[model samples]
Target: MSEIPPFEIIRASRRSISIQISKTYGLVVRAPFSVPEDIIHAFVDRKSDWIMKHLARHTEQRERKNNTLYYLGHIYPFEYNLLQKETVTHSGGMFTFSGKVKDSGMEQAALTRWYRKQAQIYLSERVYHFSWKHELKHRKIRITSAVTRWGSCNGHNDLNFPWRLLMAPKEIIDYVVVHELSHTVHKNHSKYFWNLVESIIPDWKAHRRYLKEEGWRYALPKF
Candidate 1:
């Protein structure tokens, strides 16, 4: 057998193996415990075309979304028809929330805690419903402050969601839930995986637009 290009492989206890080519990260292979390097490379070489296509498409989509940003003072939807009210009041310091609470400047520490609590209640229920409907299995759910990602899933099937998601609309929050759950089935952004996502949330495009535009602001908050 020929020596394949250098790439990363994630080995775990599973039935079938899969390979992926990323836009920014390049090729990756997730295999079961018994699959050998030579065999995995052979599989990757066999499906290189499919990998390239998925990677290109993923990159294109990411590039398109990158242009959007959520600057302060911009309006974003909240539960029901309540818009997130952005107010810079004079008190002590930090951010604060009133009606919808786009960004309430009271204190970063207090605001972060409040955001986490909100995310816990909101994200968990959505995760429960979607997971049940799709019959997807996962371990636990958690909230954190991630720099770039909105949500992520570990190999243990634990889901981590950014508390900042509370700044966005309920529908956008649901989109993140569905997107993360989709990872449980397909770990990469392949064609089949996106197809599965579309089947679940048909209007994912709008949600994604909300994220790219409104989500950018949350990511850049002082807290």
Candidate 2:
């Protein structure tokens, strides 16, 4: 708390200066247009303890996120290896990437390709299992890289799901499958949709809440 950490300043038409912490950007200072540079520096110095506390928190979260990978709703330690032969492998309670990727772009592309293939194989089987159990019919199963959507059923009856769903637990995945499959029967999220979803997954709301709260953690790492 003795010295202020590095931060970027953005002066705007405002009355006060505020500090914001980011894992990627470190710290940011938003100040009023009339606030002098020295005044902003003094204010940041005065709040050094608080700023340092948040920075420490961000650091811990960043490290934890970097070290862990979510698969089938479980957190597994992850590693990258440039000298190994296999592209990727899940063994000994770890998910390791052994691709000879030279950069992060190549690394991301390789990992995402693996994630998409896993999604296609796993989700297709689950969708079919549920559809067959309930006597539902679907045209096709598509694994997508959708950011904002988890699963959707269109007029063509093709069930679309994001590869990210593979990061959630199996029950949660099943809930999404039932939810979208129900959409095949009920186009809108009306009373009938909820009723049907409840009929299939009695705790569908809990799973949905889990996704709304923690689903953001399920994504490619930023290193």
lDDT of 1 by residue, 52-121 (tens): 6566555545653422222122333222123454332213322323445433343344446666786788
In TM-score terms, candidate 1 sits at: 0.52
lDDT of 2 by residue, 1-223 (tens): 3766677999899888989987668899999988889999999998988887677766756776656778999889888887746576778999887765456676677778888999999999998898999877888899898999899999999999998899889999999999999998999999988999898899998999998867777887674
Clashing pairs in 2: none
The clash count for each model shown is 10, 0
Runs with alpha carbons beyond 4 Å of true place in candidate 2: 1-11, 15-21, 24-61, 84-86
**TM-score to native of every candidate shown:** 0.52, 0.77
State the C-alpha lDDT per candidate.
0.69, 0.85
lDDT of 1 at 128: 96
Show where candidate 1 strays beyond 4 Å.
1-106, 219-223
